[model samples]
Target: MSDLPILIAGGGIGGLATAIGLAQKGVASLVLEKASRLGEIGAGIQLGPNAFHAFDTLGVGDAARAMAVYIDSLRLMDALSGEEITRIPLDEGFRTRFGNPYAVVHRGDLHGVFLKACEAHPLVSLRTASEVLDYDQDGETVTATLASGERLRGRGLIGADGLWSNIRKRVVGDGAPRVSGHTTYRSVIPVEDMPEDLRWNAATLWAGPKCHIVHYPLSGWKLFNLVVTYHNDAPEPVAGMPVTHDEVRQGFEHVSPVARQVIERGQDWKLWVLCDRDPVMDWTDGRVALLGDAAHPMLQYFAQGACMAMEDAVCLSAELAGAGDDLEPALRRYAARRRLRTARVQLQSREIGQHIYHPAGAHAALRNAIMQAKSPEDWYDAVDWLYGSTGLEGAVSREARTLGPE
Candidate 1:
């Protein structure tokens, strides 16, 4: 086998998770980050049981669990009438049924779990300000060109670079990401700033007509992560741009006082014009492969962007470890295992935004009726394909994990 390390683009959660996952399997990896520092930008992200499965596989389960703020349920509310639509209880039963607990954590904390593990591991090397521009592969080895015109060689290349990936341009050749025309605003406030009556230990979503609001406790309940989105038909991509509270309130004026108050309490709100891509079959080329947002960017409706990326890392590291010198075939196997699953997520995220979250009048009524009729068991079964499946069987640790009520 060549002594060259596998090169990974980007240094976000997915990149670090892949680096650590590879190290756990005795494979070495070099993470090339475009930024001068390695960190996460978001506030909070929901973790399905599938994310926990991936965590264990990547050897960061315990660290991740320690930092997470486990919620009791996924509460869906009608923003118009301020009524309960339905809730999926993430209690003991849910954990036992899925072999892991659903929880919410600060994005930086979760990233730290993987980053710490990667830092401690001898097989992983981290580099900042090293942007991977494109690559050249000659069967046995792949050479990556950086933005500064420097070149690096590796046995294989995995593009974990996010949404605007430089590697994807060379690998998939698909045009720019499809803009969803949805503007999302996010903020984090002290727990005290949250409405006392609304302080529930759940991942709460107030779904309305062409808009929605989500709030959950993060960072050990020290902060509340508030994310609210509206279909304003934004024409271009935007990220982390500061917006006044009044601009955000314009979209939620119709929502009930209870549902709209989240936006009122928000401080220093930032905006993100959402975007995703139509799923494509090919994300791998020879010794190069794409992971995370680079391969399958999706709307945040399903809350599985980071989770899917970690899951990809699990399958990818497993394949690479097993394949030895055959990195091309290894990447092909990795893409085969992940393609359909990621595609399902990508498509369904858009569906959820339209059908469940943003419908109005008759559509909203139909959504509420159908969703309210489901029992916890039905909800569990509906998500079994995502949280429990054969896709992660051999990759995850079978050892049962136990957690106390939060």
Candidate 2:
């Protein structure tokens, strides 16, 4: 094996997960985080069964499970009528069918799972406030130039730098990310503050015209993560901007009082104007490749962004392990395998937002009717391509099956 550690730009979940996957395959890695401290932001994220597959494969299954709040179902409500639309059970049948449980976790807790594993691995080294500005690679090695103008060389470089990735600017060169005209507000509040009548052990979504509300228990029922989004034609892209409760309430007035009450209870609300990009085929350039949002940023409607990124980590490690010292082709293969799967997610997320979550009148009726018709088995088959398998077939799946610390 090469003595040079793989240089990973960004110390977020994707980057750290990559370090763990690579370490399990007897590879060494150095994670570069632009942040002064390594941690995750945001309230909560939903994890599909596929995420569990990746977690188990990355050798953090038990640890990840320990931090997750396994919900009873994926419940949907009609915000217009305050009526139950449908629910896909996450009971024993769901777990048996998917080979893992559907769950939710605080983003920080999930990131901590990987951070702890990466910190403990002998093959993984972490750095903070060291951002990779760009890179230049020759036939044998890739050298990353940090923001401090220091150059570090490695056998390869992986960009998991997220939505505003410097590595992606050099690799894909697609320019700025597309700003979807939707605004989202997030808040985490104590469970007691959540309405007792509405509190349930489920990842619930209240869908109305041009808006939606999602909430679920987190941190062992100590907190509730509230995310409300409105399609109010927000012009520019914005992130983590603090907004008043009145601002968050602008477009949700039309929803049922039951659903509107969820938004009213939220505190310390932060706003994020949703953004995504049209999928591009190539994300690999020689020994430099992209992962996570850096590679394929998508809307949050599908709730698969992080899950897809972790899957990228699993596949990347497997491909690199299979290639031995030949790094370039391995990286290319990794991008190829991940492109279609992630792209499907990327495009579908936009569709889900437009047609499912934010539709009006007849459209809402159609969505409710179709979704209501789905049985547990029907829902299972609908997501078969995504959650039925880890979507990392052949080499990746084979590698995942051999997971263990080096």
Backbone collisions counted per model: 0, 0
- Residue-wise lDDT of candidate 2 within 370-396, one digit each (tens)? 898889998887787788556477243
**Count of clashing pairs, candidate 1:** 0
Give all TM-scores, in the order shown: 0.96, 0.96
Across 88-189, the per-residue lDDT of candidate 1 in tens digits comes to 899999999999999999999998998899999999999999999999999899999999999999999999999999999999888899999999999999
What are the runs in model 1 whose C-alpha is more than 4 Å off?
Answer: 390-406
RMSD of each: 4.5, 4.5
Error of 2 at 302 (Å): 0.8
